[model samples]
Structures are given as structure tokens and as C-alpha cells.
Target chain A: MTVEKISSLQNPRVKQLVKLRDRRPRDEAGVFLIEGFREIRRALEKRVPLRELYYAPEWFLGENEPALIAQAEAAGAQLFELTKSAFAKVAYRERPDGLLAVAPQWKRTLQDLDKIVAGSGGPGRPGSTTPATTSAVGAGAPDLQRAPFILVVEAIEKPGNLGTILRSADAAGCDAVIVCDPVTDIFNPNVVRASTGVLFSVPLVVAESAPVLAWLRAQGVRTIATTPAAEKLYTDADLRGPLAIVMGSEQYGLSEFWLKNCDLPVRIPMAGQADSLNVAMATIITLFEAVRQRAW
Target chain B: MTVEKISSLQNPRVKQLVKLRDRRPRDEAGVFLIEGFREIRRALEKRVPLRELYYAPEWFLGENEPALIAQAEAAGAQLFELTKSAFAKVAYRERPDGLLAVAPQWKRTLQDLDKIVAGSGGPGRPGSTTPATTSAVGAGAPDLQRAPFILVVEAIEKPGNLGTILRSADAAGCDAVIVCDPVTDIFNPNVVRASTGVLFSVPLVVAESAPVLAWLRAQGVRTIATTPAAEKLYTDADLRGPLAIVMGSEQYGLSEFWLKNCDLPVRIPMAGQADSLNVAMATIITLFEAVRQRAW
Candidate 1:
């Protein structure tokens, strides 16, 4: 098969790729654009279907672009070569790496996540809807058995903070990131960029907050919300066993719904006048505190 | 005193405020712009001299703007009222809160910090260069008296990350934040915005790495550097006593100079495909871990 070459800045394909930058077109078409060599490479590695791969050799930062292009082609992605100027016009990043791919958007529901979480434990319990017992693990729990460790964020408005939260969740080895009533599009190019391609590796679910809270109750996952008004400090809280760390939006702490429904509410001790940390930073601190506890 | 009113976007004062968005102009003029009601309020509370205050009544987000303007005026600021269009042209934030101020830049040296740190302890030893004992506090230290908990970052390129780090440092109640060879200007508007006004409260020092390291050594502060290659996990390290957490740039880990010079090199355990967390997130994780250990 011959690769299509487009040199004009006004090429129809370039216009479509540029249009993908906005949420309405991206959502309507049910697809999103992934830019940068690292992002495309991760997408291909995860076997995320690459509908089309666009390249401008002159814009590549390194020698690996050719191999990546070949791999994408072998994976059944249609190949296209754009002139340097054309690629520049379609790129979302300040410094485009000349590799951009259009991939179909995907979604996962709580039901889909239930299977994965249940399967990760010692014995296979695929499709089991049994609520996990609240006493599944005692304080100072043993680390022999794997438990569900999830992060739930509500109405996060900033794309950069959302992406960074995903990165932290990935680093802390979270089972999944559940975004409930998300204020920012998960597919926004900035989110992808800030996540550093971990968006593809991490299991992500987007759903409403009420159902997610209900689903967590059904899964027997203890929801722990971080708030300034909480009595117990995060470090003192028992974060072991099957758990979900719930975080709130940038402008507000956890919503009344999550705070009211969560099994435990904890606060990170703030020593300065700032009163609270950024949502992303707070998530990492809280997530790692749980990680530190579970390491036993 | 009658407050001056200007409606033209082309007014020389408005043009100068717009130019303050860039680093060179901000540094050359020895002043930087602070936008948003919260940031200006924090600046005023901290007694950061306000050279001028600019406001657009039509763009005010709340009824409290008039009180804030009066406070700034009483604090010796020259007030200017602008048309909404003029304020929009000069504002850095996407959603301006109808408040802006130009504050003169200030500097703090290691010598100055030495006085502050020495003063914060239970007893005053102002201007004394006597090195703190290496074993100021044993592992699992008590929280009776404060220790110098400083955050040192080298060559941070993004203004947003730099600002966020400052916010975290402030929340962690750090004694000071020493910036070494910073690539991003600390006064950049994005830094100010991302910091959410924590910039005014946090004691920030801009200096070179070698001297800061030397100052840390002279102060008997243990330097902790986080790297993926470290043999020790951050949680497992002894973080008590006077300490300085040194973070590297976003792209690169700590410089060889810092990595080789630091007392302890530890790593945050990463269990994901992504090798590391964002610098600001990592800094918070490590800082809070220290906060946890010291709380005991």
C-alpha cells in the first residue's frame, strides 16, 4: 500500500486533525488525536488501535521515528506523510515530534473495572458482583494478597492537574483512575501530554459520581475522602486493604455527596497559611501514604 | 486622593503592565504584576510593597473588590481604574478578578536565611554560623522544637511547576525554598497564579547550587536527593533533623553536582510503566514523608 503524501497547508486531513483539538468535534466523532513520538509509541505498545499515523520526517527529534512509523504501519495504521509546514499547522504541542495519530476514543464502565479488579486477586472471580467485606483486611494488614487500590477524582477542572494525577496514580500502582463528573475532557491533548502517555497504560473509567459511589459500596471498596474538616490526619488513618482515594475539584474540596458517603474522611496536616495543597500534589501525597502503609 | 482612571488599552501604564508578563521586562523594571483578588490580598497581608494597583469595576468577580482596593490604597499604593477592555488586555489570567498590583522584586540571601532559621528555633542565636549538630534529632524525632526544613530545587523550567512546588513547600511548612539556577522566572505570572498566592507567604531564596549546598553544609542540614537509581526508598530513609530536600529540573533528575554532594540519595518506589512522577508531585511525596516521620 502506498502512503499518502500531503504538502498543502490547507489539506483536508490537516484541517480534521486541527479540529480534533477541541472537545465538541472530538466527542462528536468519537475519536481523539495523540501527538508526540512517546505518546504514539505508548499507544501502539498498549495495542490502542491507531486509525491513522501522520508524520513529517523533518520535524522528528530523533532517529527512532522511522522504526515507530514502521511499527504503526505493521499494526494496521494508515500512514500519511505531511510537509514540515503542514505538520506544524496540525500539531498541538509547542515542539511537535512529527508523529501524530488519530485513535478511536474508548470508555470503561464500573462493571468492566469490576472484572479486572476481581481477576487481579489470588483466585479468579471474574464477573463476581459480591460486595467485598468491610473486614477484608485488619489493621497492619499482610501484603501477601493483592487488594484493589483505586483513585477517584470528581469534577477536576484543569487538564494539566488531571493528567498529573493520572501520572501519580500510575506511579503509585493504582488499579484504576475513576473520573466522576469530570469537568475537563480526559482526551484533551494537554491531559495526554501531562500524563506522559500513562493515560494508555492506566485503566481509566469515566462515570457519574453517584453511581461510582454506589459501585464502590457494592465492590466493598472503602472510599476515603481528603478534606480539611476531617478529624483524623491522613498519616494516622488506616489506608490498608481494598481502598479508593477520593479527591475533589481544584476550586473546592470533596463534594458534600462524596464527603458524606465516604467511609473515612482524612486531612493532610497543613502547617502553612495556604490551607491546602494543589489537588494533584494532595493526591500523590495521600496515595503514597497508602502505598507506604501497604508496603508492610 | 483621587484615583486615576484610564480607559484606553493604548495607555502607557496599561502597555507596561502587559509587558511585565515576560521575564526580561519584569526583571528590568524590578517589579512584577500580581493579578486576582486572592493573590493581591495575600501580598498585602504579607506586607509585600505594592507600587501600583489596577482595577476594572466591570470585571470584578465579587463585592469585596472595593474593600481590597481601599486596603491597597491605605497601604500606600497608587491606584488606577481601567475600563474592562483595558484590564483584559493587561491581565494574565484567563478569568481576571478585576484586581492587579505591581510589586517590587525582593531578594533573600543564605546569610539572611541563616538569621531566620536560627531565630525560628526555641532559642535565638541570631547571625551565628555555628554548624548545627549532625544528630540534632534521632530517627523518629519528636516535634517539640522546629528544625530547618527547606526545599531546594535546581533549574526548574516550567513556571507552573515551580509555583506549585512553592505552594507545596508552604503547605508542608518549609522553613524556606531555595531555587538554584532556575530556568523559569519565579515572578512569572503563571507561577504567581499556580501558587494561589502562596508565593507571598513562602520564604523563597534564589541562589546558586554550589553555595546553597555549602550553606546547607555549614548549617549542618542533611540534603536528601530523590532519584530513580537510588538504592534506598524515600519512605525507608531517616528524614528527621535539620533537612533540605533537593529536587532537580523537570527533564533531568538532580545535577551531578547535587547528586554527588547530597548527604542521602533516596527514591520513591515506582511500580508503573512510567519511570517517575512529576517533579512537584515527587517533592510533595518526599516532603510529606518527612513530615510524617517528624510528627512522631
Candidate 2:
């Protein structure tokens, strides 16, 4: 394993890592930072390619730091020791966890998703094709052929909200999360943290609404758009079948395309003065309803 | 009719408003800042005790500024017209609506809550005790005697999460929200913004967990504690009647007092790698289940 000491804050690599903080630079470089031991471990478990791992021994909090570093090295990550100040400069969190990594950005298009679902002969797996049926199935597994549940988020602006939604989708046993026209980057460090690294565990794809709608239609998956204007209540909808729950930006409801083209549009009944819920909260309520119905 | 113009940022009242940004001064003064036209309007609608109203004519966006100013004056609020720089110094939001207010802090103890609930002969009305049976009954009213749903949040630290939960409780038509041992101030500006002024609409009380739980037990309200470790799924629990959903902080699960003393403990099913959901999202899922069951 190659190990190097990065002592200067002005190092070109450190400058590049700092630039990755913004969306444009991350996109341009096709890489993003993953901080914290748990997040990095999740990424490695999901086989996300790691270009480099930076750690500050003095600031490292976890007991298994050495083992985790060894594991990362085994997984082909070039390890580096960062000075305390240099580590602080690259870390996003207030209390540094003493570990950060630059991982190659991964993307799955609508077409690529088709291959996974069809090729796996079960629910699609985005990051890896191998069936992780043992660890993936928690209480009871969804009948992948008939009850594949998907979550579709559109134009979501907040990284934390998006990450929380991903976490919920994972908890509710969603087959995948389709992010369409997101205002926030999926690989944002905040997203990684807020998701508790569940982003790497869940199957995810990014595509425009038009193609995604068309793809779901082709696959015979019913799209349910959540909007306040819908007449029917969310609980009244049939979500036990192959389904996709589409949510819109917090500021605006679903776009014209989703409102017009989605198979069903339903609203979570709101009885108070506040017009709606936080988008992530709405997604959890909608997804868990499916979980309840499917279990029955 | 009494609107005095204040041109200096260093004015005593202006300085006081600026100091309200932090929790210490807000607590000491027993007052908090309310910004935005919608928030101020909601405060007025709820008859929240407004000590002062400040507005900048140049920055005011809404057409009803004059009418709102008049209404505040009629309601006994001291009105002030602030210079552009003076208003900018005190406003919390970017692109201020040219409206800000100093509202007296409101608190409700466990005993006060009993009076409101029992006095209304139903779910206690906060602002008006006459019981708004007409507008409060959204779709179908909960049989208040049998099915008054309350949300109990314990030791929640984030102002935004607490506020979002307030919004959800309102959306779910929860009778009242009891904040138990809160780490975040219920009247924090972020909470106010996140709730979108639902803070005014929802009847809320703040007290320690032990007393709150004791009060619930005495009132015959079934306290359902949400914990990841609970075996019973939240949906399966009987939530259609006199219910109080107890939630713990995001970092820690419920305190020993709640876990042992609450009537029942339930868990939201998790099928993915994430161990739990965001507290606000969890509250939405749990409360809406009661809403769904009660609808039947």
C-alpha cells in the first residue's frame, strides 16, 4: 500500500479536494468527498471506487481506525496522513472524524437501470449486479417480480432532505430511488452524512423526468405523484404493486409533466394551517404506507 | 394610526431586536423576533401578543402592508417604520419582506394545558377557547372526547426539526403538541420559519418529561413511545383514540423515564441499512397513522 504524508495546506491535491466542496467542481472532476468512518466503510462495502483516503491520527475518534485504514488500503485506496490543520481545511463537519476520501462519481441512467432490473431477475441493483439477497432482506423481502417499490424525487434542493429521504427509502425497503432533475447534488458531503451512508446501500439512478416516466411506463410500474391539489388521499391509493412515489420540490409542487403524466396523483391529508410538510417527511409517510400495505 | 419612523440602527429598540437573534437575550427578555409578512399575519390571526411591529415601506413586498399595519395598530401593537438600513440590521431572512415584529414569549405548563383541554370540552383551543368546531374539522373531526391525538417531543435539539414536526402535527390534525424537556427553544426563529407559522396555529405546551407523562397518565391519554428497539410496528398499535406520540432526540433514543413509563412503545419498520428515520419524518409517519385510523 502506498502511503504519503500531506503536511501543507497549499498542496495541489488539498486545493483540489477543497474545490470538490462545490457542485461544479465535483461534477467537473467526476469525484466527491466522503467523510467519516461509517460513510467511508459503507462506500467501500458497496464497492464505490476510492481514489484516495486522508486521515489525521490525532483527530480520529473510532476504535477501529487502524483496521478501517487497512481495509481501505486492501480495497485499492491510496492512503495519506493529513496534518491536523490540513484535515480541518478539507473536512465539512464541525467536529472532524479524522477520515475523508475522494471517490469517483457513479451514475446510472434510465437505460442502465433497465438492464439491472431485467438482468437480476429481481429488484434492480444499481452499484453492483450480484444479488445481495441475504444482507439486503431484513424482516421480509418484497416479491420483487410483483411488488418492486421505487421512490422518485424531483428538483429537491436541500442535500440534507434528499439524504434523509434516501435513508427512509432504505428503511422502507424501497427497490431504488430515482432522482430526477435534482437541484442538489446526490454526492454532496451533506447528503452522504445525512443519509448515514444509506445512499451507497440503496439502488439509485439519475434521469430526466420525461425518460424516467417513459421507462416506468414501459416497465409497467405505476407512478404516483404526491401533490397537495390531488383529490384522493395517499392511503386510498394502491401502493402494494410495482410502484413509484414521485415527489416534487419543497417550494413548488410537482411539475406540469409529472402532474399530467403520472398514473395517479394523491395527497396526504393536511388538517392544519400549514399548507404542507417538509418534502422528506412527506416521502416517509408515503413510502411507509406502501411498506404497511405490502406486509399485509 | 401611531407609526413613528426610526432611522438609526443604534436605536435601543433596534439593538434589542438584533439581540433577540440569540437564545440568551430572547429568554431573558421573554420575547422573540417574528419576521416575514405571512408569519406576522399568522401571529395576528392567532392573536399572539405582539409588543411591536416594524416595517420598511421601501422593502415591503406585499400589497396589504397598509391594511396589516392598521390591523396591528387596532390590536394594540406599537408600530414603527424602520429605515432601510435599520430594517436590514434586524431582519433574519435574506430578501426580507420589510416586516418584523417583537412578540411576547408564550408558555403553557401541564396545568394550563388541562384547563385548555377540559375547558374547551374537547381538544383545547389555544387562542380562542370557544372551540372552533367548524374550521377545525378538516374533512371529519376527531371525536374529541374519544380520539384527541397529541404529539410529545422530548429533548429535541434542532430548531428546524422541532418546527417541521409542529408543521406535521398541524397537517395531521393533532389536537396539541407537548414539547417535553426541549433542548431547542420552541420560539426560535428557525423553528418559526420551518413551521411556516404553524407554531401559532398549533396548541403547544412545554414541560419536563416526568410531569408531562404523569399528566398524560392522569388525563387517560395513551402515551406511545417511538423507539427503534420496539417490537410492535407503529401502524399495528392502536392509535385511533386519546393518543400521544412520544419522540426522543435524534442523537439519543427516549430517556429511561419515557421508555419505562409510557403506556406503549412502538417502532417504525426498517428494511434497509439505515437504523432509523429523521425524527421529524418519524413523527409525520406515526401521527398520520393515527389520522388514517381515526378517519375510519
Candidate 3:
């Protein structure tokens, strides 16, 4: 596990770092980005396929730890020690913790998810341990294709917000995150960073609202629109069945078309002076309600 | 409304902008900072009190909307215009929106909340609305003071997350955000920015675990701790009662003290590979449940 140093930002290997910051390059390569020592460690620990590891020796104090260095070395990850200045040009964060890695997309299909659930012996997801659990794929779930305890985000403008929602989706164990009319790329560098790498952990499908909704309906998923104006409270609406919680941008909530088509309009209750929560915040509440109801 | 432009970062007025960004300065001066045209417009629309407004020509695009300029002038707001480059230095945002405003803090008290509910005749709080209603906040005839909802955020590190929680607190109409122990400053600049200025809107107070539990017990706020381990689903708990939902950081979850003190431990059921949601996202979910339980 020898340390190799790369000073030129234009080096073929260094160019990959620059490209990782750009969404198109990341997508074209079919690989996801992970940065920082902890993120790199998580990737290595997960046994997710590794592509390369870039480091700056002067800064990465963790390099002295043989075990940490050996783990990446064992995986055949390309290691590059960079000058701090050179690292800055390609690092995701201004203060890159001296380790960066790019890993092939963590691939899992709907069928693959089923196999994991069977293997887990509790449920297909974490935090879902109900003995009587409804199957997510082609089960009695409504809108099995269009919505099934899923989340549809329409026209979210901020990458941080979108990624934050993905983090929540991972926690709530929502089926998938459907980005409808995205204003920011789901694979944007910032989104991936903000998601704390949950982007890799979650199954994200991006599509236009029309097709997204159409697919959900085909799958027998009910479209539940969460809004400030609603006939049903979020908790009372039966979330135990096939469901997709639809939320909109912060300034303009679910579009009229989306709202009009909602099987149920649900809202989180509030008592303080707040008029509304941010869209990302709203998504967490609605998605978890689905989680709560199913677990109960 | 005259367009006054001053081009100098060293000017006394420019120094004031720096002070506004600092919480201590704002607190001593009894003010809060708001930047960007959209935020300024919202403040004016709310008829919120204003102290000052500053900007550069780049923000207005030379198309003068009298209303925007007049709102400040009518409010007797002192306006200053700087050279675009100087304005850029003075403004917090990279793409300077040009306009920045300083307004007195509107520290909402219990009495003022009563006035809002009475004037509008809206629901008092969660669990107070009609059973069939889905309006998140209006679900019930709100009970403002004894509003059972409470929030306990444990050891949150990011300023953005804290700010977002405050924003969620306002939207969820939470009683108060009880920071069990926070890792980041509640008043960090990033928190203020991310909250969309809700830092001034919500009742956020920090307290240790014992006092928090004591307050909950005194208020009869049923303490519900959210964790990955909880077998009973969040919805399974009687959410309608006086409730304090406790959620900790993603790393460790609610502290041992909270765990020992909580009346119930609940979880948002999940069906995904990722184990947890961001702290901010989880707070939104917990907050909405209180919203949902109280809605009816």
C-alpha cells in the first residue's frame, strides 16, 4: 500500500475527479460519487464496488492508520496523494478530508429488493419489523406502479432539498424517490453530498410528472397529495395500503393538477405561527406516516 | 422613492451590514437579518416592521417597480445603494440579490398567538379539528397554550438542520423546540439562511434532558422517543394526547437519558436499505404526527 502522488490536475486520473463534480459525466459513466474519509470508509465496509481513491497525504492524518489504508488498498482502489491546492479543484467540499472515492452504481432491482427482504427475515427494509408486512412489489399495494408508499417530488428547485428528501425517503423506507419536473439534477454533486450518500442507498427514478403518475396508477398506487389545505389529516388517512405521498416546491405546493387528482389531501398539523414547512421537511412527515401506519 | 447609491465597503452603513449578520449584534440591537429581494418582499407583504434597506442597481435590473421601492420608503426605511462590486462584498449571498433589510424581531408570545387564532377563527392546534378534515393545522379548534405538541432535538450538528427544524417548528406549529443538547450554534449564519428566516418566527429554547423531561411531565406532554429500535410504530402511539416527540441525531439517536425518561419509544417504519433519515427530516415527521393527532 504505497502512497502515489499526483500533482497535475490535468492528469487523466485527476480529470476523473473534475468530471465527478459534473452531473453529466457522473451519469454517463454510470457511477456515483462518494467523498471524505468516512464516506469512503462506508463504501469500503459495505463491500460496494470501488473505483478509485484520491488523497492528500499532508492533510489526511488518518493515513497513518494502517488498517484504514489497507482496506482501500485491498480493494485495488487507485490512490492519489494530492497537494492541498490541487485537491481543492476537484474536491466536493472546500475542506476535503483527504480521501475521495468513486464507486460503480450500487445496483439493486425490485426483485433484488425482494430477495433481501426474504434474507433479512424481518422485512425488506430497516425499521420495518412488522410480522404482518405488506409487500412493496406487486402486492396488494395500490397504485403498485404509480405509488406504493412512495414519494413524488414535483419541481423541487434546490439540490440540497432534493437530497434531504432522499435521506428522509431512505429513513422512512419509501419505495423510491420519483423526481417529477426536476429543477435540479437528482444526481447533482450537491444533491449526492447533501444526501450523506443515501443517494446510493436509495432507489431513485427520475421522470416527468405525467409518466410518473401514470406509472404509479398502473402499479395501483394511490396518489396522496400533502398540502396545507386538505380534507384529511396526514395521520388519519389510511396509509397502510398502496400509497405515494406527493409534495411540491416550497413556494408553490402541489400543482393544481396534482392536487386535483389526489385520492386524498393530507396535511401535518401545526399550532405555532408557522404558515408552512419547507417542502423537504413536509416530505419527511408524510412519508414517515406511511411508515408508522404500516408498522402499527 | 429616490435611488441612493453609495459605493464603499468601509462606509459606516456597510459596517452595519456586517453587524446584522452577527447574532450578538442583532440581539443587542433587537433586530434580525433578512436578505434577497424575495424575502424583503415577503416581509413588506406581511407588513412587518422594518428598520433599513440596502441594495445595488443590479438587483432591480433597471426596471423600477415603484411598489418595491415605495414599500421601504413608506415604512421610513433608510435605504442605501452601493456600487455593484461593493454590494457584492457586503451581501451574504454569492449571486447578490442586492436588497438587504433589517427588521425588529417579532418574538411571538402566547398572547399574540391567541389573537391570531381568534382573529382568523382557525383551529387551535392538532387533534382539534374535525375527524374528516385534512388541513394540517386547521384540523382542530386549536388549543394554543396547552397545545400538547412538543419537540426534542438531540445533539444536532449542522446549522442548516437546526435552522430547518426551527422552520418546521413554525410550520408544524410546535409548542417549542427543546434542544436536549445541540452540537451547532442555534444562531449560526447558515442556520439562519437555511431556515428561510424562520429563526425569527419559531419559539426555540434549549434545555438539558432532565429539565426537558420535567417540563414535559409538568405539562403532561407524553414523551415519545423515535428510534430505529422501537417496535411499536409511531402511529400506534396515542398521538392525540399531550405529546413531546423526541428525535436525536442520526449517529446515536436520543441520548440514554431521553431513552430512560421517555414514556414511549416509537419508530417510523421503513422498507428501504438505508437505516435513517436526516435529523431535520425525522423532526418533520415527528412534528406532523403531532399535527395529525391534533388535527381531528
Candidate 4:
């Protein structure tokens, strides 16, 4: 396939890609920029829809860039060659890897998550005969027997923290991540970079807190809210079962709505003078505790 | 004590305070900026020597600001009142609480730590009658019988990550934090800010890795290095003993020197696509596991 070449810094496409850096344009246009080699690869691997691929030959360092570009092209992505200066204008990092992509924003709602979880053969009950599935069971219409272990985050404000949480969720082999009333854009460039591409690997859904909670209840998933005020220690909570660990923003924890609604409210023991842990750190600790209990 | 008032942003003291925002000035002058009401209070409470306290009357928010200021004054800290504009020029946070301080940078060596640990009535042998001490044994020279559970970090580059680790160390009730061969200053403004003044509340020591490892050996503290490449999982390690959990930077795992010298190498199990976790998050998870095992 012939790659279209664009050298001008003032190119309209470059200007549009630059505009996508801000949240409003990204929201209105329904597209976001994915930069760097790993992120683009992860997006493709996750089957996130790609509209265009831009690469500057001089700055491209990855040995597989040609193969990646070919793969994107085969998947119907329009490929463009960018000049170094032009790429600089559109690139987010100090040292751009000479590759970037404009991908359509994918939205997954609570219903989609419910279907995905239900289709996956939901996590087996403790002491049940059904074998525990360690792999994510989606994309192929999951076998309707596996249980789901979900992470619910309410109003996370920092893109970096959100991304880190996604990485942890991925590492813990969590089924899906539900973002509730996010304060920061899920597709924020920093979030993509911070998650180190785990954002694409993990199944993520965005929805309002009430709807998400209601859906989980319907799905027979227990919701555990983490709050500093909770009397029960996080370790004491039974996390091995089908669980949804709900975490709030660092500045303000779970709203009264969640505190009143969640099945359990637990606190990570804090022996320090500081009242709480960083939200991402707290989420990882909580997620891993479940992982430990499941012996997965 | 009379509170000196300064109104000009051009004031020499204001310029000096602003320069303290950077690491060079902070290191060269042997002092660091402690911002916000809580941080200033924590520093004073920790007995860190304070040279000056700056506050703007117009923006003061904390109800206990007067009491805190009086305490600082009683501790021999010179007090100054700045105009809003002047304070804004020197303040780091967008929503300043109208409080800041210049405190001398405190350094703790392995020897200091050795004395502190030894004085604390170091941890008794397993099955011994000596009860494990839950309190910090410093200030008046701890009874020389308690054992120390420490957290050792090597070459941590980001002030934010380092600060977060310190906060975790405090939360896990680790006796002290030793920053080994650090890339970022322990008293970095961001470290101070990110730690939320836990840097003051937690005893912190900065030393080279060689000396730190040697010191740990001398103190009879088992050194466990965390690396993704390790064969043993962190949970499988015996962490209830007098121990130090050593972690390296994200980009690079523990240096060969550390890896070769550490008593044990362990990895936190990763079950998903992400290779590893953010260093601070990893440290917290590992430390909390120890805390859980110790039942402290």
C-alpha cells in the first residue's frame, strides 16, 4: 500500500491531531491520539478502531514499525508519513518514537460489561466443581460459565493514577475495569502513557456510579468499597469470591452514595501519620489481596 | 514573639525562598521548603530545625494556624508574615494554605540508624520473651533491645515516587526508610509535598547501597530485594523477622551490586499483560504483606 506523505508543519491533519490533545476536542470529535510504539501496538492488539497512522521515518526506532504499519494498513487504517518537524508538533513525549495514531474512542457501558461477564461463564463459586479461568474470556463471546472479578473506580481525577490502576488491574488478571463518572478522560494521553499500554489490554467500561452498582448487583457480584473511615481491615474482607473492588479519588473517597450502597466498606490499615495511601497504590494492594486469596 | 512583615515580591528573602524550590539551592544551603500547614506542623513536631516560617494573613485557612505558629515560635523558629502577592510568588501549590517554612535538611547515616535500631531494644530473637515494640525509638535514645524493620530503596529517580514510598513505609509501620544512592534529593520540594509531611514523621536515612547493605548485615536485618526476574514470590518469603525490603527504580531493576549482595530476591506475582508495577505501589504491597504477617 502506498503511504501518503505529509511534510508541512501546518498540515490540516497535523493541526487536528494536535487539537485532540485537549479533552474538549477529543470528546467532541470522538477520537484521541495514541502515540509511541507500544501504545499503538496495544491498541491494535486490543482491536481499538484506528482511523490513521502517522510515522516519521527519521524518528522511528522500533524495528517492527514497518510490520506494525503494514498490520494497521491491512486493518483499514490510513497510513501517513510525517516529517520530523511535523511529528514534533503533534507528538506528546519529549522524545517521540516517530509514530502516532488517531483512533476512534471506544465506549463500553455497564450493559456491555454485564453481557461480557455473563458470557464469560462467571467466576466459579468457592468450592465449586467449575475450574477457575485465569485468562480474560471475551472477544469471542465468552463461555457462559466463568465468573468476573471487576474493579470499580469512582471519579478518578488524575490520568496517571487511572492509568497506573489499569496496569495493576491487568497485572492482577482482573476481568474488567469499570470507570464511574470519571473526572479525567479515560483516553487522556497521560493515562495511555502511564498505563504503559495496559489501558488497551484491560477491558474497560465507563458508566454512572448508580447504574454500575445496580448492574453489579444484578450480576451477583459483591461490591467492596475502600474507605479510611471503615472499621474492617481490607485483609479481613472475603475477596476470593466474585468481587468488585470500588475505589474513590484520593482527595475525596467514595461518595455517601457508594458508602451507603456497597456490600462492604473496608480500610487498608494505616499505621502512619498520613491518613491514606495514594489511590493507585491502594487499588493495587486491594486487587492483589484478592489475587492472593484466589491463589491465582 | 514579634512576627516580621514583608510585602514586596522583590524582597531578597522572597527570592531566596523561591530559589529553594529547586534542588541545588536546597542542597547547597542545607535547607528545604516545607509547604502547607500540615507539613510545617509535621516538620516542627519531628524536631526538624526550622529557620523561618512564612505565612500570608489573607490566605490563612487552618483554624489551628495560630497554635501551630505559636508552637514553631516556642521551638525557636523565626516567624514572618508576607503579603499575598509575595506569598504567591514563593508558594508552590495553586491553592496555598498561607503557610510555608525553611527547615534545615536533616541527614541520617547508617551509623545513626544503627544506633537508633540498637537503642530501640532491637527485635528479640524468635520465641524470645521480649515483646515486639510498636513505637519509634529515637528522640531520647531508645532502649537498646528492639529489632528494626526497615525499607531500603535504591536509585529512586522521581521525587513523587520516592515520597509515595516513604508514605507507604510509614503506613506499614516500617521503623525507618533508607534511600540508597538516590537520584532525587530526599528533601526535594515535590518529595516533601507528595509525602504530605510523612518525610518528617518517618525517620529517613540517605546512604550508598554498599554501606546500606553492609549496615543491614551488621544490624542482623534480612535484606530482601524485589525484582520481577526473581524465582520466589514476595508472599512466600519470611517477612516477619527483622527485615528490609529493597526496591529499585522502574526503568532498571536492582543494580547487580544490590542483587548480588541482598540476602533474598523475590517477585510480586504478575498475572496479566503488564510486566510489573509502579515501584511505589510494589513497595507498599510488599511492605503491607510484612505488616500483615507481623500482625502489627
Worst 10 residues of 3 chain B by lDDT: B132-141
Q: Highest TM-score: which candidate?
A: 1
- Per-candidate DockQ vs. reference: 0.45, 0.54, 0.46, 0.40
Give me the runs in candidate 1 sitting further than 4 Å from their true place: A7-12, A57-59, A83-89, A120-145, B7-10, B120-144
- What candidate 1 keeps of the native contacts, as a fraction, is 0.77
- Candidate 4 lDDT over A1-296, as tens digits, reads 88889999889998998999999999999888899988888777766667899999889885889999898898789999988898999999989999999887766666656665676444322212333221331222233454578899999999989989988987887878999988989889999898887776566888889889888998889999999899999989888767899999878989999999999999988776656478898898899888877775
Expressed as tens digits, the lDDT of each residue in B1-296 for candidate 3 is 57667787788878877877776787787776677765566556445566788777775644543467578879778777778877877788767767777776533223333333233444443333233221121223344544446677888887777877777877877755667666765655577577765554344556667876776675556888988788987766787766778888867777888888799998765544444466676677767776766766
TM-score of each: 0.87, 0.86, 0.77, 0.83
Q: In candidate 4, how many Å is residue B185 off?
A: 1.5
Model 4 chain A: weakest 10-residue lDDT segment is A132-141
**Kept native contacts, fraction for each prediction:** 0.77, 0.82, 0.80, 0.66
Candidate lDDT values, in order: 0.83, 0.81, 0.66, 0.80
**lDDT string, candidate 1, A1-296, tens digits:** 46999899888898989999999999999999899988898877666778899999999999999899999999889999999999999999889989999988877677757754564343222212333222220011112247789899999999988998988988898878899998999999999888888787666889999999899888888999999899999999999988999999999878999988999999999876644477888899999999999998
| Ranking, lDDT, top scorer first | 1, 2, 4, 3
Task: Sort the candidates on TM-score, descending order.
Answer: 1, 2, 4, 3
lDDT of each residue in B1-296, candidate 2, tens digit only: 76789999889988988899999999999888889988888877766767899999989886999998888888788999999999999899978989998887876566655643443454333324343332232112233454567899999999989888988998887777889888999889999988888887777888888888788888888899999889999888988767899999988979998999988899988776646477887888898888889899
lDDT of 4 by residue, B214-274 (tens): 7888878899999888999888888877889999986787999989989999999876664
